[model samples]
Target chain A: MSVQPQTQARTRRTWLRVFLIIPFIVLLYPPFYNSNDPTFIGMPFLYWFPLLWILLTAILTGALYFLGA
Target chain B: MFTFNPVAFTVFIIFFLIVTGMGFIAARWRRGDLDQINEWGLAGRRFGTTVTWFLLGGDLYTAYTFIAVPAAMFGLGVLNGWFAVPYTILVYPIIFILMPKFWSVCKQRGYVTAADFVKDRFGSRTLAFAIALTGIIATLPYIALQMFGIQVSLAALGIPLSVSIGGLQIELPLLIAFLILAAYTYTSGLRAPAMIAMVKDIMIFIVLIALLIVLPAKLGGFGAIFAAVAKKHAASPTTFFEFLSPKQNWAFVSLALGSALALFLYPHSLTGVLSSNSKNVVKRNTALLPIYSLMLGLLALTGYMAIAAGIKPPKSLGANYAMPLLINAQFPPWFAGFAFAAISIGALVPAAVMSIAAANLFTRNIYKEYISPNASERAESTVAKWASFVLKFGAVLFIIYIPTAQVINFQLLGGIWILQTLPAVFLGLYTNWFNRWALLIGWFVAEVLGTILFSAAGLKSVYAISIFGVSFPAMYTAFSMIILNLILAIVLTPIFNVIGLGRGRDITVATDYDAEEVLPVEAGREALG
Candidate 1:
């Protein structure tokens, strides 16, 4: 059950870095990609803004499980 | 302010009084050595899954979300209002990773606040003090925002309006509300607030579900509602449908992401985590709390309904009153009263929890540490109780003095300030590589820079820039500050390490996260010592 301090610390760092970067990529790209026309399930990129959080949650949870576990 | 129905007002008062009575009794819910800080402030760290779920929901979904989210959507259109949905979704996973470790460490060391853990891990009172100070300071405006939520709800209920004489209003009813809340919170601590949260959550569900069902019928139908919204957007294209535009998309994403990171870092959220009895409780709550987020999405739809129903907010009132106005305009008088009570109760539970969290920080970090290092457990608990009272009173003052229109800005301003604490909190949770002094320095830089940018943008109510000739609000300001904070910490940590300013100390050997299922000997010793 005991995790080596070094390994745990490294895992924590990796998770932190991923958290910092993922939001940037997800938020920054979609606006640019769909600047001309945005559509997801007949919803505009604007309408999809809130729903994007679903993907963000999955990514964050997956990363946390990977690193923390 | 509308006229309050006599029968409805009577019922609401009776319900509120009953809850207040229960809160006082809650002081004894989880009986323990009443002398200790943990026993008083964290309910002896013994809440199981069901209680913890209700507790966290009550703590997180405040009157702000209840009134403000729908109000924002109703007033500004869908783009601005979507922030709540994402922010709630993001908070779950972040906490899932962080809370289990936090719980383990806190339980093992008998720590009452995050500052206690920082102090133990770093072996530096200064660092711990900084953490405590940041937590208390950042949480104050938040507490004030809750009071603001109450004031908005009360104003909508016609309580404050009826008291107005010539332009001089007597806010006696609102004052009375704060006094009642302060009394119960001082008596019962965490138990008082946790117990009340159950009532608050139930009321919220009832009111929201009723509004969702009833409002569409009032608005003619979903198609009519959307059509009205479309017309509104068509008239003002810049503010409404164009999501990728600066005011909408970037600000929405940035605010969502920034808030998600900062949400659990708040001392109140940490209080929720440390109060849990087991790690499984935290994990289970994490997966299930999304149900609240789903409710939040449904709640956001009320704004669209308001627009369709043609419910225009009064000139003096803020957008936060839109939902209340819509309810009064559309629902039966008794139902409107019930919905108003839901919002009022929503403000009460979170405000109570917030003050308790702030008070705990003051007692554990300030009073017990520098003020009297050898302070007894009883003395610490006493300080926490008094601090909670004073903090709630201060929030009452904030509600009284600040104009309602400015209250929303103050909430956002509070967010900007609190987000400054992320590097110190989220980073320090796992590593000692961040020098205490470096963390402090980073906090200072971020606070200064973020404030300047936010203010200089002229409270433009939006910060946008031209990217390839498209205008977008500069939503990334918080993210920018966090980045700057991290960079400052990273840069200064090594320099301080080289200079031996804040050398790493021995962290507790027992990994508290793993201690969740099993009762570690260290946890027992720490708790009973």
Candidate 2:
């Protein structure tokens, strides 16, 4: 439960760097992937895109909290 | 084409007046040190989880979502409607990480606005001023969009454009509404709107859920509606059921990303964070708020249902009345009046909070930092009150002067401009690598390019594009600007750092990011009080 200030600082930096890369990945991907159908969970990939973001956000926040970043 | 029923209009006005009266009485509720900007602008930063939830919900889900999303779906089909779901989902997590840190820093330093944090953290008033100006300018169009929402609802209700009083013709609906909003926001500060938000949000939930259930059943069911929409898209072969072309796809993705980044950067969202009683509240809400997105998805579908029901929007007024028209046609007069009230009340709450948030930025960053530097808390609060009033008035003017359709387009344009502020905001939360000058340069580049591209695309009318000899509507321009912004920000960060442009000492020491078990006295009070 206790973290040194320096360790905590380094962890925070790592997490920030990780999160900053996500938008780029999500943004750069094409609408439809050749290997996958355009549907995700019975809706078109386009329709599910925002829902994807919702999940992405939750995972990222959980990571940051667990990692103590 | 759109006419307001006199009986419905009278009822609407009476209800609004009652709410306004209640809002005014709320001024004395949960009294705090009204002299302080935090007290006035942020409700003394004392809102617990329940209050914070309603405040943020009310603030974020404006008339824009309640009316505009369904309207966009009705007019433009799936593309624009998609924005609603993504925006709500994206904003929560983005704020989750950024907001807690911001809250800590602001609490540590007694910062009331995002501009305050920027000023103190960077020790540069110029950078702070730029951020403040951007928040206010960007928020103006957004507030105007809310007014547009109210106007559309009123038009749908058949309210006449002007009312004559003893041979004196007056065009005063928008003006009257704005004045009422300005009064209570000034009187009760954040709390006035925060309390009102509870009722507003509950009404929205009830209305939306009732419509979602009843509308589908009334319009030959969901299966029938989807079939109609699919048939319509197939017939057109140009607008619906088609992904953006490659060029447009880039724009779509970029706009979404840029907006996601810029969203929490808005002063009002930050005010919500600062007002929360604890970091846990922020975290919990990140998970909880997505429930609204679920509701939004249902709301978006109502547009397709409107189309399926064969309810044509009034030609003179713009398609924003699609929801109201559909509801009016399907329901009886009293229930339709209730729906109109839901949308109107929805617009009022966020507009009030946004004006208050922007005014707080002006007071804390512009007035106190630059104007007096030694201004008292009372002086800061007074300035914020007047600034909020002026902001609401300016929004009314924006609605009156600009064509409704053009104003809606400008709101999209404003999204592009606001998205440019991401690096200075979201990135600044946990890193010091980005120099202030680089952020400024990135923001300027994004704005200029976004404006040019959006305009060059001719406001992206009707999603027209040719893929292998087939065409579709254009929805790619705004997204393109976002890409250019990111590249510029990323590319310029190291360059500016290498050249030492706007590179100051790192004010965020490592210890600042840590979540403490034993909170400091002020932070503890801020979280628990």
Candidate 3:
């Protein structure tokens, strides 16, 4: 019975690691975020999206750490 | 000849002296036997998360970065400069994955330099020597650029960098500052820079905060600043870019990806990681270090602020002067002096760390391996201290005598040369199935061919390749060479193994890569010394 929970915990940890790839997928492909229509304040989507991701990435990394990833 | 500003000079000197004092006092901070190489060079691997975060930030985001990145944005535009944003953002994820494993292995087996780890893992002294030589050579031009950072700061403050003494022109202020840096590094070793980095980061944060708040309000807003950039881009469409042009997309993505891969591979960056006490410390820092990346991205926008404010630097100084000139024009003299001092101190921290890192590689891989086979820990540390001093002095002389353009050209090549080691260092972390000789040949081929490609592109780092009468869009030369390097290593590894030429031994166990920290050996030895 205990072995089943151990495997479940291990599998959950592995899935958490996959979330780390979100920033790379979103930021690395410039064509996806390279638009001007979605301007936050006055900054372009190209500029503000990457800047916003810096915070979101940090929060994600921190979450991964706290969740025992 | 130089327009002197007394208030600025005085403020700069005061901050400089404070850090100089801190440099000396840092030797006593976390008491250890300064005679041991690990103790002197890696701060006995004792730093917690906060110190490691500051040290790596100060080491990686250098003084040249402050002058050059904004200068690129102010002079050119997004594709030329702002790729650094994505580049820095991408670095943390890579670090989060790789550095904790690296830290664990190094801590378990007592590896001081990346070359030291490569030497043991591959069991080829020749391969290790190649890595050590590449690291030392690549770092020299980088150190020279740090001195260039100080020169720009002083020049901006209206302080003369050189003075005619007797018949020879001497860069007096720079020489004096370097001497102080060398003295502290020699006496305190890595501890000096580690401690000073904290102060440098705080000062830089203050400068960044002040600039972000003041510059935007004065020059309308982010919208106006970027609109001004668009207007200028329209005026000279070919020279400036408000965003990556269709043709520039490949180059932009390649540079960001390539540079993020290369940043931690540099020996100085590894030194910062190795100095931390635990794998968790290194891991936590990846989450924290993006604060500086955020600051750097905002700082890049000051280039657009320069445009909106209509601050024109002297034509001779070019766009490198744009940030300094903007600071001079907009801020009070006292604040300007404070900012220049922050930049100059910023240069000293990285310059000290790079020299120590290069020195550590020489002492561990070259001098100990070749010259003195059984040198004591005290002897190794002693040699490293002197080597760090000599390396910094040589860099100062090189910058003073060599033309700045020549130094800049070599620094451009330094990035390409250093990235070729990625196959051996980064990939070797995961698998040692690669034959050592194959890795060496791959490195050699990449170095020679990359240099040729860089030159063919007229000394530019980005190049368009034509193969079989088909042309591809320009990409970072380093990225293309690294791909070639990996292919060569992969193909030749099997051929070499088939011939029974693979004699490499792995001294490190698999568990070493995940081993949690033990109390450092130096802790017990501290009282004996």
Candidate 4:
């Protein structure tokens, strides 16, 4: 096994996995987008913000899976 | 309260018949020998990505989402309701990391249940037995909840909740619906739900999108609908809010996190995952399944739409009827039939999967292990088929004999109870470093403490509590007990080691966990041949 290159690829995938958890953590922090400002097509940011992140996280996961991580 | 709307009833009967036909025919969808437990119980472990997506999305997001999410919001706003958005969003990422490994190892070991994995990994039948009993016990109420969902929809469709015959007042509609679900599930096994889910999900998405478009227009715009919600919340700020109140932040976070963790631990969810053919299918689903979460978000808003349309649930049914009542109020009679059928079909899919999953646990861990260790695969499959019916009837008995309030409470306890197995099942996926005895002790402590805390809190289904002179904010009893459970598992590991209690040999190697190759069903069958 090529130790150095394998470690580099493993770390890259680990970072990608960490990216997956970001949206989960972000949506849980209520203070960030808990207000009714920044509405999207009449939905309060409170609702639309997390809804948007659901897709964003999905995109990130799709990327990670295809990347063979 | 019951008006005979001929159009709605006819349309409902039409869609209901269509799905029922789909269920019976699904037995031949992928003609496998149903004699083997693996073939019958887990769809022969042969589902590809798209099928797995529909099956899991249909299985995990139940009538609970269709009725309860909107109803909760209509009744109590953000804390009670909208937490599901975060819960669903958080669920995938967690599963993305955890479930593929679970699929991989379970496939390699031919493990049908988490208890199977626990018994093999930890070398303890007692621990495996603990996990199986908990899965079945937690699942009975969950299956009953889905029955209750169908009952609510039936009640909305103008069927009486009960009919008296020969001094016997029976819940005729629910019993009839449960029988249909039981018959198909017993015959078709997991394939029944996987096939019917394709139709149920389509109807649900259609009903959801049609309502999202039509209800907003009828009730003015989303802005107007929310403004009415705002007005109501403005009047009673304590009960309803667009955002979480400061006091509710912990409750919201813990409820969302605890539920996200517990979602996959449910045997029904595992049945959906293990039915898939590959790690890649499970991984692909992590990306695709959020379509339901988006639908859940849109559907939850219908509660506010119900309010804006000035629809009121009957005082008898309470707030859980909010969405069903809103459906009847807002939609034309024919379309209302389709919507009601969507909700009721939604109930059948998960109810079938739940009973099969529980029955899989019962047959594999209980009967095959204890009753007849030398039982043939065909006999095991037979037991699973019969047990699925009996387990489902147990759920039916729950609905008939138990109050709906208590059933919902039991469902909440189900969430708490399943999370107790996290250390043994989820954590053990990575390492068997923790002693099995200590892990069982952790599970026992959490189960007893969680139940005691829950009961001590009275009829309130979920709550937070103080531990050792420190008061945590009001949150789910499950989340709090899980913290204590984790602490005990961690602390007791070293002590148990010092006392020379063996953790048993790790039967699973790293390569078992690292099996990422997808084996399609033909190759799997040839291997069997």
Q: What TM-score does chain B alone reach in each candidate, compared with the true chain B? A: 0.92, 0.90, 0.96, 0.96
- Residue pairs with backbone atoms closer than 3 Å in model 3 (clashes): none
Across B1-529, the per-residue lDDT of candidate 2 in tens digits comes to 6555666667677667767876887677678887788788888777766778788888877777877788878776655666556556666656765777887777776778777766656556777788888889989989999998888777778776558889986657767777888889988888877878887788788888889788877777766776677677778767664344445554354445556666787777888888876676776677667666677777887888888888776577556777788888887777777778878888888898899899998888888877888988788899999999999889888988888888777777777766666666666776766667766777787778667766776764222335598654454444555556668877887898787676655565555654543534344344333
Q: Write the per-residue lDDT of candidate 3 for residues B1-529, one digit (tens) a residue.
A: 2366899889988999999999999889788999999999999998877778889889988965788789889988888788888988888888888888888889888999999989988989999999999999889989998998898899998887789999889999889889999999998988898889999999999999999999889888888987898899999999998877788889999989998888888889999999988877777788899998898898888888898899777677788788998999899889999999989989999999999999999999999999998999999999999999899988998898887655666676788999999988888789788899999999999999999998988888899988899998899999999999999999998999899896699888898887845555434344122
lDDT comparison, 2 vs 3, better candidate? 3
Ranking by DockQ: 4, 3, 2, 1
Candidate 3, what DockQ? 0.70
Clashing pairs in 1: B104-B512, B246-B472, B246-B473, B463-B473, B463-B474, B464-B472, B464-B473
After TM-score superposition, the amount by which residue B372's alpha carbon in candidate 2 deviates from its true location, in angstroms, is: 2.2
Model 2: how far residue B291 lies from native, Å: 1.3
Against the hidden reference, what TM-scores do the models get? 0.87, 0.86, 0.96, 0.96
lDDT: the better of candidates 1 and 2: 1
Candidate 4 lDDT, tens digit per residue, B91-126? Answer: 999999999889989999999999999998888898
Candidate with the larger DockQ of 2 and 4: 4
After superposition, which runs of candidate 1 have C-alpha atoms over 4 Å from their true positions?
A: A1-69, B161-169, B246-248, B459-473, B519-529
lDDT of 1: 0.74
CA lDDT of A46 in candidate 2?
A: 57
- How many backbone clashes can be found in candidate 3? 0
